[model samples]
Target: MSRRLLPVAVLVALVAALTASSSPAAPRQRPRAPSGLAFYRPPARLLAGRHGSVIWSRPARGTLRLAGAKRALVVLYRSRSLTGTPIAVSGTVWVPKGRPPKRGWPIISWAHGTTGVGDPCAPSRDSPTSLAHGYIDYVYPELSAWLKAGYAVIQTDYQGLGTAGPHPYLIGVSEGRGVDDIVRAARELVPALGRRFAIAGHSQGGQASLFAASIARGWVPELKLVGDASYAPASHIADQIKLVGAFTAPSPISALGAEVLYGAAAGSPAVSISALMAPPALALMPQLEVKCEPQLIQPDSFGGLAPNRLLASGANLGPLLALTGRQNPAVSIPVPILLAQGGADATVPKPFTDQLAGELRAKHDRLDYRVYPGITHGQIPAAAQPVFMRWVAQRFGRR
Candidate 1:
């Protein structure tokens, strides 16, 4: 939430926090891309694997290591886009040390928040320390806590981040598929991973987890989903878009709108970046090649740009807006859901989540919505751990 400038390019280097040792050492640099993926070419065989099928895997070293995991592996697996075309997705999985329960370790499909659409920005390839210590407390103690409870964790980098394709960014279906397929791939790679699992995420991942809940059964019916937890999820995209359009000064929300508009353009053949953004903003798109969230939200990136200037005057954004809403629909979920929001979150305002809670309730979806009094978006995942864990434990039969 601090708008003050920080070195954004080094976000990947900050992965040193993932190390088990607490020494105040320099941040670990991001590991290099495997030689097989040197040019972002997934093997042709990877494209033919069924969704959630693992094509290849390698042990992750350097900053990709997990603190309490007995083993962590970087994997490339098969998944689909919103259009259902075959695509390769990448992620990392960490299995706890010690013997598994009789039923095997339950899985936590951790959908990550936005980083960038570029391959180098992939969290599985970069440093997960960002989750543990980066811009936000998005996936730390929650991930480690679950690991300590003897659960396996599968963290997806979405479709485009590590593999070839336009990362759909906030496109919920694409993100959700990434989450679902990773869990499936992990199960196949390690037969000991449990079929019963929960989906949890923060911010953009939160929204993705919800969509996963809607599709998990049909997409991968073999898996048994217990419940879901979404923390400060990106909801009400259309409403948030309008709010971003109204911002005069540079704002983080506007940056999100820009990034999302860029993403929509990437995923849709009908949508074009030129049509969605003014020439000035359009010209800046190249900068996104290397920058992810940390750099994109910087005031310097905006260059005094406003969200209203992002589109052609009077352009029909209805298609794009409709796509956003459709990708993140509000259909009733049969499984139990827990949504935690931060009252002080300026990024994902409280009202939006509150409205979502109301709609979900009206639909009779089982929900446990909690809003921390003074927490901000970045703090919600860590701060809400107690209640969050208790709920998950109940779903896990009082673990």
Candidate 2:
């Protein structure tokens, strides 16, 4: 039997056909933004907070009941981007009921995973039936579990998302600063909020948490960050780029390649979209920025990209690669770490996370790496909940 290498364009067209037929809204020209996110607009400059300071805060509409917490509100806070430019960020904070332990409730600064670079993709904008509601917002169960266990949860929307500007997706410094600054904003908003805290994240957030642990002492020295926990954290960016490039069609893997390219190009002025992607792929780059992850996953949204076509062959990826490597959780974490990885995770493959764990250990970073067999990337956080709760309890000196 003769075998033929599948043409990338054909594969993409097939994917598009499948997706278009399945999705009722596929016929629509422009995808609609997720519900409850259309009206996101922060004031021009509503009094700045020092770094993590809350510029202004208000009750988050329609989030209190869904979170199952005593109180929940959206806070528009101040955070600098990767380039150290002043920008407004938004996040949701849930305050649990009942009495505090005199020291106040310990905080769980939560960093979310990839939700697209679009402004409407912010986790705080999640609503009942929206895409974010399914992806990031559904974490209510996890957040509710923590609330029941008496830990306040603060979820950052990160810079550029939910407010204005180009979201610096996966830029460690930008993301980590957003995570750290939100905690600072939380403290300022909730007077009863405790200084003692832990950072927990899934996927991209996992990487952000690692970065947070490294920089917390210097960035926000006032907050007492005990430890960090990463669930299926992202690592090995150089290898990841290769993995994305290896895909031959318009699959989710290739979509990620396009997304990262867009992010890298957006973050650094040195890089240009046209320089990295071919004309066809470059034409679609603008869509990658405006659509949510779910929309992007729809095959029609991403025209199949040729292998190695999106990433320029001769372009020196050194600066971008260096930035990525720098964003990896350095072994310099001052506190202990709890990492949970899914053995069967395809998105963030087990080998990469295992290797990351080994690297952390080699640097003498305190790590409690736990692996759950048969679990996938999205399932790791919830699957490892029991372990996470126990580990977090111990970190807070609770039984």
Candidate 3:
């Protein structure tokens, strides 16, 4: 049997106009003045503060605001890297209107799926009407729903997306810690916010949500993690890499394969890029560090290459495989979990999620797994919105 590469069109459509440039015919605009990117650069002294403590925060300007949010804030906070070293993370917090329900608004700590490893891909930098809006638009309505339902939402940009470190993409511990710590940062920023929160995410975020659920009770004991809701969460990453290694033709998912290699190498000292990547792939690595997903997946980029071509011939993948295998979110979770998958999702095949759900079920891990018949990967969040929102609400003890 042969593996079928995902159609490039599908991947392209999912990130439409992500790398498109402004028309040359348009009037020349003035170069934008310096902005708050400096906020991401935390002072050295602040790194010594407690993890999850707020370093600094300001009002979320322009399009960073959620539709139903009464107030929004851009925040930089302390968090730990995959190696337990202290790092700064940037994110946004949105508060609901007319709060004060005894203990204050419960939180929904949101983990977003892949945009890219680049700083420019950070969601906090997105305007509702900007080119980057394509990425935000997918989840904006869903986030607005949570805000409207009276849940305050906090979004983490992960370790390196908008911060000053190599993004340990798909490295579970780093991503999960960011997800968990941000909830604490939110509570610290807004004293009115309740300590209760439910971790929810899509794709990469879904995986992070599971990891966050597993470690929240221990990592941030001060806060209460009610449950986890993952929509088409990424799983079977090691197996996927093996499949990529076997591909002999151009693959739309090659960019993701490249990202996996980059992330694995960045997160662990034992995994070396020179030892794992082929010359062709190695030549393109600088772009991977700076380009967002859309640009990285263009035909001229990783998208035009076969996955096997990305790996050096007879490259020892053992270390890389072991590192990624550790990131699978199939382990036992300390809280109730709602795992939803899309039958039509090519990015994360149904069988992969089935195995993940099966593993958790075998552990009697308080799991609620659902499969939507026709939903694609990008559609899972929207398709499962009603169920997940209700599930999150139930966990928080609301209607």
Q: How accurate is candidate 3 locally (lDDT)?
A: 0.84
lDDT of each prediction vs. the true structure?
0.76, 0.76, 0.84
Alpha carbon lDDT at 148, candidate 1 = 86
Among residues 3 or more apart in sequence or in different chains, the pairs in candidate 3 whose N, CA or C atoms overlap within 3 Å are none
Q: List the residue pairs that clash in candidate 2.
A: none
lDDT score for residue 3 of model 3: 38
Poorest 10 consecutive residues by lDDT, candidate 1: 19-28
User: Which segments of model 2 are wrong by more than 4 Å?
Assistant: 1-40, 303-307
* TM-score per model over all chains: 0.87, 0.86, 0.89
After superposition on all C-alphas, the RMSD of every candidate to the true structure, in Å, is 14.4, 18.6, 16.0
Residue lDDT tens for model 1, 73-157: 8887778877778888888898988898877788889988777666667877665444222532346567877788788988998
TM-score-based ranking: 3, 1, 2
Best by TM-score: 3
Q: What is candidate 3's lDDT per residue for 1-399, written digit by digit as tens? A: 223545666677766553222101111221222356887786676676668877778788887887999989988888988667889898999999885688778899999998877788888888754434576668989999999989999999999888897888899989999999888788777877887889999999999999988899888876778899999888889888887756888876888888888889789999999898899888888887667776777888898888889888898889998999999998778789999999999889999999999898998899999999988998988999999878987898887
Instruction: Please give, for residues 1-399, the per-residue lDDT of candidate 2 as tens digits.
Output: 224545766788999987543222211121222234433564555434368766556666765454547878787777777767678888889888888778888889999998888776888777765555567864678889998899999989887877887776777778888898888777766777888889999988898889888888888876789999998888887667755556665666556667676667667887666766666667777776567777776766664555456666676777677656665665579889999999889889998998999999999999999999999988888898999899999999997
